[model samples]
Every structure is written in structure tokens, then in C-alpha cells.
Target: MTRDAGRPVATPSQTVGPFFHFGLTANAALGTLAKDGVRGERIGLRIRVLDRDGPVPDAMVEIYHADAEGQYGQAHFDGFGRLPTDGDGTCVFETIRPGAVSTRADGAQAPHVNVCLFARGLLRHVYTRIYFSGDAALDEDPLIALVPPARRSTLLASQPSGEPAVWEFTIRLQGEGETVFFAL
Candidate 1:
């Protein structure tokens, strides 16, 4: 590539990854949050990443959120976790359910975990949120209200049958049933 006159030529864009496992995974608390004495209901968050074809095993999943009391950065609560997907395209985080976050004086945001997805073929990572399926606050969340009712389910993480403590969320990068990624 060469400069044209005084202006530099635009280069073609490239995908962000094939992430280097060592750099992203080194010395990281990969998927365990809620260490002992973190006051909240302990639960497992199971995340699956998929493309139009099938499961995506090479993706990295990260989540950060408020603690059980809607407070973040507490000494005992790390409030963050990151993990690479396994061959099954799944990663599980053992953490406590976050409490409802008060985002406004007149309303409260629903309890949710903020998620980021990093995978091959993406120009940059994408952001999303995972809301518990049955949370009553979901009906009133300002953010949730912004999403169309038909597409809102993509943001929900549902508990599997007989797995009361484990919630499963699937992220679809494209095609039908694609998960919604927020611009922010």
C-alpha cells in the first residue's frame, strides 16, 4: 500500500481474532466469581455461542455486573469473569445472581449481567446483556423497553429443566435467532 499524494490510502479491514489463548487466559479467574462470603444466591451461568451453521468453540465470553446488593467493586466480590468456549461451544461461570440496579431515581434496572463476545470473523467485539427469564423487573426496565417485544427473548437467559440454579444463554452471531448486540 502506498500513499496517494499527501493522503494515505485506506487499507482493507480485517477480523479481530482467532484470539491468542495465552494472552486472554493467562492468570485470569476464568469463570469463577462469587468467592466465599459473597452474600448472594450462588448460581451457574452457562453460555453458548453459535453462528448460522452451528456452535462456535473458539469464542471468548466475558461478563461483568453488580454484586448481590447492586453494589460493584466490593472487596469480596470480583464481579467479573472471562472464559474461552470449550469444544461444545459452552462456558460456565459460577457466580451469584446480581441484584436489581437502580439506574434512576424513579425506576430500577433489572438484575442482569453485561456480556461481551469476542470471536473469529468479527471486526470488533460486540456487547449485550443477559436478563433472567422471570425477573419481574424486566417489565419495567428502561433498556428492555427499548428492544422490540419480538426480539427481546434474545436477551433472556433461561433456567434449564431440573437445573434450578443454572441458567443458559445462547448467543447467535448471525442469521435466524440472532442475539441482539447493543451499539454501546
Candidate 2:
């Protein structure tokens, strides 16, 4: 008789947290921005975050950004713009591509979306920013550079489905590919 030579396989375990029960509600701030006067058409962004075990139904995901012109001034908007995730841990946003921002360095900042995470288990919110894929400006982005090169893909948004103009991205809370977090 021959003994099994394969390495022992470990089953993935699920981790539970307190912030998993929060429900997403539409906010006036986000609503107004969606209808803001921007030249370019608004695109829908769907974000899904899976818990360690699987998809977290009630995960609270929030996305913030400026109008089509990429203006986030107080006069243009009031209160922090936030959109929550749906029942499937998915959040949808109707907005336009953010305009370029000036960075500390000589180069300009790339267009991107800022993401904030608040789940059942965590007491405070985790801050993460998502970048666009194939953006020529991404090469010179200062914020994206902060993240490790190996993990940069996690923050880049992908368009798996939907129209050619529409953009989509899925986020994994923990495990193989996790979104990159910032200090602030």
C-alpha cells in the first residue's frame, strides 16, 4: 500500500463581524450629485465586497467623488457624498469621471474614485481609494504609488460587464485579493 503524498489541504474558515447588519439608504447629497450638470454622461459603478467566508449581505460600502468636472468644492456640494451598498454587499453609483487633480509633485493626479468601508465588525471606517484601469494618468498618480506594486491591481476598477462606457469593480474584504487601504 502506498501512502498519500499530497500536502494536506486546509478549508477556508469564515470570520464574523459586528458591522454586517447595516442597511444602505440613498442620501440627498449623492442624489443631487447624480443629477449634477456635467457634460459627460454619468456611469454606474457596482461594488461588491465579500467577507472572509463569502459575500457579506449587509456590508456598508460608501463611495465619494466630485461632479463630472471633478469639482468637490463646498459651494458645488453640501455634506460628504456617500452611497451605501445594497443587500448583496453591492453599491451602485451614478456619476461621471473625476477630473485631474494637482499633486504635491509636478505631475497631475489621475482620475479615481474614493472608497470608504464600514462593516458590522469594525468600530471605525476604513479608507480605501479605487483607481481606473488603462488610465494613462495612472502611471503618474501619487496616491496609487503609495500602495505596493504587487497589490495595485486590487484597487484598479475593471469593466467585466455592462456597456463599453460603464465601469465596474468588485472588492474582496480579506483573502487573496484585497483592496488597498490608505493611512488617512
Pick the lDDT winner. Answer: 1
Task: Return the lDDT, model 1, position 114.
Answer: 97
| lDDT values for all models | 0.90, 0.68
Model 2 TM-score relative to the real fold: 0.76
Q: For each candidate, what TM-score against the reference?
A: 0.90, 0.76
Locate the minimum summed-lDDT window of 10 residues in model 1.
20-29
Clash count list over all predictions: 0, 6
Give the alpha carbon lDDT tens digit for every residue of 1-184 in model 1. 5599978898887777676454674544668898877799999999999998898888989899999988877888869999988788899999999999887577889999999989989878999999999899999899999999999999999999998999999999999989999998
Global CA lDDT computed for model 2: 0.68
Clashing pairs in 2: 18-120, 18-121, 19-119, 19-120, 19-121, 20-120
* Segments in model 2 whose C-alpha atoms lie over 4 Å from true places: 1-32, 74-80
Model 1, position 112: C-alpha lDDT score: 95
Which whole-number lDDT from 0 to 100 does residue 25 have in model 2?
A: 49
